[model samples]
Target: MSVSGDKIRHRYDRLAPWFDSLEGFLEGLIFRRLRKRLWAQVQGEHVLEVGVGTGKNFAFYPDRARMTAIDFSPKMLEQAKRKRERKQLDVHLDLMDVQSLAYADNSFDTVIASFVFCSVPQPRKGLKEIYRVLKPGGQLLLLEHVLSSNKMMAKLMNLLNPLMVRLVGANINRQTVKNVQACPFKSILVDPTSSDMIKLIRAVK
Candidate 1:
């Protein structure tokens, strides 16, 4: 990794604690609806989540599905471990990077990412891996914050993105949905949130 990327990663390691704390609030207020919507499309299968911060989606997954979640922050993964301690579930949480995943090609039946595309050092490379690691016909479920088509909002996000990434380890101006659709997968469902900040999309590869 470059020096800048290394520095950015160290920043995330430091912020993991605060990020972990917000998982509950985020899950209750935001992810609940998004997860419920995507859960119907992907269930009872071998599932993998990239950038699986604090394992927020672990509970949302159906009981029958075997879930393996990977994240770059060890501290974040440790917090996730604590959260799952009481729930006897089939979930394996790993501290791993997204740009270079260790899993084999076509290793999973489904792949999910929730609000994760923003901070990845190379979002396109990570998406390609998400594509390669999925079994044929496997679904890719994504809940992403994206660049708005609204000119005013887009301009605002572009202005804030660099500072946001520096302070919060997040990018506010990523074209996450467009990047995902650029792959070979056929987009089966795309439900854009009315306000346009987030979108729930499911694609079949």
Candidate 2:
């Protein structure tokens, strides 16, 4: 069976045209605290956002900073470009993969991701690439839905994730903290529960 990642990507590609509607529906339903936390990390020189769905975090990026964003699906990237064009924001957008990126090592000052880790095929390889692409002391910021501490919820997630991922590129339960810890980056963890259901992490290479 093909992994859920491609299916999820395809789902997003199909949904790209109505993405803003989905974003509108998900606005208040999304993670605010983690969003703010990760946004604050967007203040550096060269900011790289992976899985930058529709350029949602572009506004939070420091106005003076250069922004480069990538996604696996061209359809998603197209919507993202349209969004950027509407905003008149000069953002570099591309169709790229997280696990194997084209950027050279130590190229970016800050690497950012939001709501994206769960679908990546090889999480460790992605992290290694993230580490390699970031300059020393450069930070990695992430805001994501993660596995819950509640055992019952965790159990349910373990069972239903495969099916849920089939319909969307994201899973309800990804242990992003464990993945961060295993990466070379020095991780700082913050778990804030409100509406967003997120894991806010800032790690340095």
Q: Which candidate gets the maximum lDDT versus the true structure? A: 2
Q: What TM value does model 1 have?
A: 0.89
The window of 10 residues in a row where model 1 has the poorest summed lDDT is 1-10
In candidate 2, the residue pairs with backbone N, CA or C atoms under 3 Å apart (3 or more residues apart, or in different chains) clash, namely 8-169, 31-196
Q: Estimate candidate 1's alpha-carbon lDDT, on a 0 to 1 scale.
A: 0.78
**What is the RMSD of candidate 1?**
2.4
lDDT of 1 by residue, 145-187 (tens): 8889899989999988888887877888888777877878865
Residue 156 CA error for candidate 2 (Å)? Answer: 1.2
Error of 1 at 109 (Å): 0.8
Any runs in candidate 2 off by more than 4 Å, and if so which? Answer: 1-5, 191-197
Q: Rate the local accuracy (lDDT) of all candidates.
A: 0.78, 0.79
